[model samples]
Target: MNLALHSVSYAGVWPGQERLSLEEFIPRAAALGFKGVMLVAKRPHLSLLDYPSHQPEKRQALRALLAEHDLSVHSLAGYNDFTVGPERPDVPFWEHQIVYIAELAALAHDLDCPAIRIFTGYNRDGLSYDAGWTSVVTGLQEAARLVADFGVVLTVQNHHDIAVDYESMYQLLSEVDHPNCRAAFDAWSPAVQGLHGNELAAAVRRMAPFTAYTTVADYVALPRYRYEPALVNYVEEPARMLGVPLGEGLIDYGTFFDTLIETGYTGTVAYEMCSSLRDGGNLDSLDAYARQFQDYMSPYVAKANAGVAAATAR
Candidate 1:
């Protein structure tokens, strides 16, 4: 398996694009030994959201920058139109959501992204679990099938909001029922539902058979999970968020990595650490923190690589 990173780790540095263009992020990531960079497909690039102007120029520059930096575009972090609420006979909610999803699927295909990350549709408004899940599964299945011919994979990711747990994620993938549509296991997100290492393991095992890719980040246990809905829905600062340092966080990475091995999962494990100060007291802290994280996880990653080599050798 290969190790990569989501360049969004440096989100703080993005607003200062003039000071540091997208090209700057590639070398920074490459220097950290990242095998690839998963760039966000938000307005700055393509998509209906925020591609104000110079969008075409920005897209070309991104491609050139990747070539110049010798980096591969592992995935597109599109964060598409996967949402949830109760279904209704009169409401156009479900139809609108599905149409939005199909449009995003075509956009993903046009950008040449092999995979696009989506969240499970769940709304807290008014509905039973069954109703919400059914709507989610139906929407995802139809949309995933729609994009299958384009060779694009619709991967349901474990985002914080409404992502129930291991069982739910497993079920959603199964319900999709298309070979090209698969799961992108974002393991740490389950902690939001208060599951432990063993429970997480079981979910991973269940999802593995259908998993096409995986995203990883260290989940730091917080003092208390506050309900901060405004920003990232994170309750408080110093919260138990993912994307901290490799081993310092609460996630049982040893178990997670072993589970990946046991499941025979052969895909890139991208380092998705997005912590603000966890990199260090400053933005420039990435260099030092990246080295330490690589050093800390090296033994396990090396062994994982060795196992792959031995198997490939045969």
Candidate 2:
């Protein structure tokens, strides 16, 4: 249960976010007591274009900086939408993604990272479910084989439309059938889908074997209202969400972490503020929220570690 902060929090993609360069981000995370960090493999951080494997000078410099702060690259986050247009036979979208993953795998290897986070493709309209599922399975298998050479694992996060739930994710990993393919299972998706209590724990427990790491964030839903002029009434719109501190949101991380730890999960648990947060996304607010997550997660993480220590001692 190593606590890590995702660099995306300081990437400033969200409005009003106070951003930090990678140089500034590493030390800040160390100061916040993060044992490791999940570096986003995009611009405003470790861009694959900028830190290619050929650039040993840049990679070595980054490695030196990480060592200076006693921080590890727990994982590298790669953004890939594996779903491609079924109509465009001329397009090389799937091949392009495989190459992109290879590049990131090399980058991760240079930084001594063991895993990289990725996504299953969305189930886009106009494509058959079978086709999309097959594409994702094939893509992941290829990516796994490519990265296996570097001893890097591709941990698929449950964030997209395809293979999003526990059963589907487990099936996808099995079909991929590569030892380097694993899961970056998160509670957010299952919780949002109304899985809680023992149901949630069961899902976590089932996915534990393939789970390489887990990313954590919480959110509370805010219902929306729409004015209806004809009826002279307000209609209830679907609820939108804003991010909150770990335990304050509707997500039941207690059961989530407890199940993972019980199943012998000792990988990094990362915190990310990928959306508009409860407080403003300004620098002070972001820092406060990040620290709060660390505080809330520390005890659970400590308990897990203690259990591990006792077991090892025995």
| Model 2 Cα lDDT, one tens digit per residue, 184-236 | 99999999889999999999988988998899999999999999999999999
Q: For model 2, how many clashes?
A: 0
lDDT of each: 0.64, 0.91
TM-score of 2: 0.97
lDDT of each residue in 1-314, candidate 1, tens digit only:
66666666655533331222355668888777776767655533345554323355555655666677777776766554344434455666767765655655555554456776666765656776666677677877887777676677777777734445667677677776777677778667665565557876777788788777777766565475667657867554654453466777677767777887778776767765455444353445656655666677677677777888888899
The worst-scoring run of ten residues by lDDT in candidate 2 lies at 81-90
Q: Candidate 2 at 120: error in angstroms?
A: 0.4
Per-residue lDDT, model 1, residue 191, is: 52
Off by over 4 Å in 1: 13-21, 44-61, 84-112, 160-163, 192-197, 224-243, 279-281
